[model samples]
Target chain A: EADIYQTPRYLVIGTGKKITLECSQTMGHDKMYWYQQDPGMELHLIHYSYGVNSTEKGDLSSESTVSRIRTEHFPLTLESARPSHTSQYLCASSGYRNEKLFFGSGTQLSVL
Target chain B: AQTVTQSQPEMSVQEAETVTLSCTYDTSESDYYLFWYKQPPSRQMILVIRQEAYKQQNATENRFSVNFQKAAKSFSLKISDSQLGDAAMYFCAYRSAIRNSNYQLIWGAGTKLIIKP
Candidate 1:
């Protein structure tokens, strides 16, 4: 089983509030990714990390920022949340040299 | 940049029957991987099946199988003896073999699979 985990399964907050979504994996994978998805829509890659201390922006533009201080942890933070940011965020981890992504349970965020 | 396409937005299958979902991609790299993932109401994306471009033999897992045509850039999933538990949003994804851009997954707008019991 995939050991990737995402916290705050669901969140609802007012706009301008700061929020952080936590993601961690116990699988000792080298690569991790953050994706934003709307209900029934395609997934948009927001941020990704190849290893510890390596974080890069994905194809989609996102105001949120991510930090990879540890290999097992990659958390995303939105300094000022907006209603437009309301969506499901998925965390995934892959092996050293492959693209077979193992996904998390996902966190659904709603900014009011 | 590689792109994955799932033209069918929604599909329905009767319990105990079979169904197939279409997926296609565009890529310049010859060695790549194609994946099918299922997302239930719980919102966990589960890997259904996988196919390697260089492998001529198709990939299968239990009742799920993939028809991967490298030349056609087509990868479709066929579920046999469908069950209500199989109902979910199925996403088709692609990744390159090249070292520089292998980390990214090119995703298709998923197809929602509804099972009629």
Candidate 2:
């Protein structure tokens, strides 16, 4: 199993509340990614980081933002939670492009 | 840009039978990688298999194998002697080999496989 961990396995919050999803890995991986998925929907890349201080927006336009201040930590934050933002957020780390990705259990968010 | 597609949103097979999940991709880069990931009800993305586009030979891991047709842009996962444990949502992914890109994986809509006892 990967050393990656995500906080708040399940979360339910009211609309307009700010929330942050925490993801950390002890594997010292340079590549980290965050994907958003709804029930029976395709996984959409929302944010990614190659290394410390490097972040990029993914294919799907996400209002949330991410920061990579350290190699092991990549957190995603939503400024104003909306009902549409309710989905499963997955965090993954990879040591190399050819290597397999280690994914966290994922955070199931619900905005009411 | 690269895109992966899993046309079969759902599939089923009897226990101990063989089942295949289809995947196709579109890319301009000649060098890249393809992968199959399994997400069980537990919601953990597990690596099932991988295939390097540069290699002509298919990749196999015990009960899992890939039928990769490079020319046809087809990469399918075949689970031999399917087991109940194989039931899950399977995703096909593609990664570019370009130097500038950070090896971002393009994912497909998952195919949920049901194993009947």
Candidate 3:
């Protein structure tokens, strides 16, 4: 069973549209991360949060923004989506005791 | 900067046979953790096995085992008695054992395992 969950497994939107990807973890993990992946490619870290009110940009640059107001809830928002934003967004969470991450079903976004 | 590489983009194996998937990483840090994750057609990323760099002993779980060569910077997953369910995209990952709660994971391009009957 997956402790982490992501909403809207698949999405298609026009350019200039705004969208938010929701991620929630039931495990109450303090560490949450967002990774962008291309088909058959390596995963690129885009955003991460240590806990509530803590968020940081990852190694990879992204136009999207993320907020961690609640311990279990972390959402990524793209104010103005573009074709370059079209990719799979994966949400994951991990506890401090062990660094093993629990990943959620990724959200595939397509911008036309 | 750390980088993990999986040379084989794809590998084929017959059912009930053994196969090894190669993984090598480049890092200056001495202490870290290595992992192998499997992503099947279901698209769910699952943890297959893990190895700690500090340990000299290898890690194994049932049909899955890892030949971790810390000095050589190599971590390979060997599957014994391959099953159809084992056919999936296998990824190698690296993580620092640091105390930072916001630790990040470094991943490879992944190798697709094909099981033939």
Candidate 4:
């Protein structure tokens, strides 16, 4: 089983609320990624980190930001949430390039 | 640019029957990886099977098997004795094997598999 974890399995917040989605893994993986997905849709990569202190934006443009201060932790924060930001956020990690990714349960965020 | 295509948006099959999900990819690189991932409702995504470009043999795991035609750039997943647990959104992904590449996977839109009991 994958050791990755994402907190707040489901979240409902009002617009303009600042929120943070937590992601952590115990497998000591060097590559961590955050993807946004809608119901019955393809996953869109939002952010990824190769290792500590390294972060890059993905193909999809996202208003959220992420920080990789530690190998096990990568958190995404939204300064001001909007209804457009409501979507399922998934966290994944891989040990090496081209390796299969292990995913977390995902956080479903809803902004009212 | 590499692209993965899953033409079937949704597929249905009777329980205990067999079903196939089609996937095609466009890539110029000869060496790369292909993957099948399953996402159950309100659950995490998990790897179901994978096929390497250079491998002539198709990859199989338990009830799941892949028909990989590298020449046609087609990779299809076939599930035997389909079960209710197999109902989920299946995604096809492709990753380039070229060195120095970021190793990001290009994903298909996904196919929703429904097993009718």
Candidate 5:
């Protein structure tokens, strides 16, 4: 099993609250990604990072921001949570392009 | 921009039977990669198989295999002797092999596979 981990597998919060989703991998992979998915829906990429100090927005426009200050960590933060932000957030890492990704179990978020 | 599509929203197969899931993608890049990921009841995404666009041969792993038609822009997965553990959501994904590209994955909406014992 991959050593990657995502804290708070599930969370329920109210509107206007600020929250951060944590993702960490012990494999020392240089690439990391974040995706948003709804039940039975396709996953939408929200953010990705090539390495430390490198971050890019994904195909889907999102209100959340991400940071990659350490090779083992990539955390996502929402300035203000909304009901529309309710969804599952998945974290993944890969060694190189076309390489298989190691994904976390995922964090399921619900905003009221 | 690249896009992956899985037309089957859901599928069902009897235990020990064979089943196939379809997928198609749009991309201008000559070199790319396609993948099949399974999300079980635990909701963890697991890699099932992968195929490189430049390769003429298809890819297979254990009971999972892919029928990759590059010119047709199609990549379909076939599961032989499907088991109850195969019940899950399957996603098709695309990624450009270009070094400068985002390397970010493009995903399909996914198909929910049901296995009947």
Candidate 6:
């Protein structure tokens, strides 16, 4: 089984509320990424990190922000939730030399 | 620019049968990587198989095998003796092997595979 984990498997909150999705990996990989997926559609890259203290926006523009203070932890925070932000967030990690990505179970966020 | 395409949005197959999922990609780079990833309902995405562009031989993992046609730019997945557990969204992804590239996977719109019992 993959060591990557995402907390709050499912979340539903009212609009304007602040929320944070947690992602952690025991693999000690330097490259981490967060993708936004809508149901069975294609994945949209939102944020990624090369290592601790390095974060970059992905191909898609997202309102959520991510912080990689530690190698094992990468958390995404939304200042104000909106219905548009209601989508599944998936976290993944990979070593610098390995191109394979290990993904988390994903967190399904719903904004009411 | 590189792009992956899964023309079949959805496909179905009887359990214990074989099924092929089609995937095609376009890229100017000669060397790259092609991957097949499976995501079950609410489950984490997992790598099914991988094929390096430079290799002439196809890659296979257990019942999962890929038909890699470099000249045609086609990488189709063949699942033998399909099981109900194989039902999931199958995605085709491509990554550039060039140095300095972000190594981000260019994904195709996934194809939902339904295994009928």
Best by DockQ: 4
- Which residue runs of candidate 3 sit more than 4 Å off their true CA positions? B100-102
| Model 3: per-residue Cα lDDT over B2-115, one tens digit each | 999999999999999999999999999888999999988657788999998899999999999999998899999999999999999999999887775335788999999999
Greater DockQ among 1 and 3 belongs to: 1
lDDT per residue (tens digit) for residues B1-117 in model 2: 788999999999999999999999999889999999999996688899999999999999999999999999999999999999999999999988778877778899999999999
lDDT per residue (tens digit) for residues B71-115 in model 1: 899999999999999999999998887778645778999999999
Give me the runs in candidate 6 sitting further than 4 Å from their true place. Answer: none
- Candidate 2 regions with alpha-carbon error over 4 angstroms: none
lDDT of 4 by residue, B37-97 (tens): 9999988899999999999999999999999999999999999999999999999999998
Least well predicted 10-residue stretch by lDDT in candidate 5 chain B: B98-107
CAPRI tier of model 2: medium
Error of 4 at B2 (Å): 0.5
Docking class of 3: medium
Fnat of the models, one by one? Answer: 0.83, 0.76, 0.59, 1.00, 0.86, 0.86
User: How many Å off is the CA of A25 in candidate 4?
Assistant: 0.2
TM-score of chain B of each: 0.97, 0.98, 0.96, 0.99, 0.98, 0.99
The candidate, 1 or 5, that scores higher on DockQ is 1
Pick the winner on DockQ between candidates 2 and 4: 4
lDDT of 6 at A67: 97
**C-alpha TM-scores of all predictions:** 0.97, 0.96, 0.96, 0.99, 0.96, 0.99
Model 4, span A30-112: residue lDDT tens:
99999999989999999999999999999999999999999999999999999999999999999976479999999999999
- Per-residue lDDT over A1-112 for candidate 3, one digit per residue giving the tens place of the 0 to 100 score: 7789998899999999999999999998998999998887778999998889999999899999999999999999999999999999999988975558889999999999
Give every collision pair in model 5.
none
Better of 3 and 4 by lDDT: 4
Q: What is the lDDT of residue A43 in candidate 4?
A: 97
Clash totals for all candidate models: 0, 0, 0, 0, 0, 0
Q: List the lowest-lDDT window of 10 residues for candidate 6 chain A.
A: A92-101
For model 4, the stretches where C-alpha displacement exceeds 4 angstroms are none
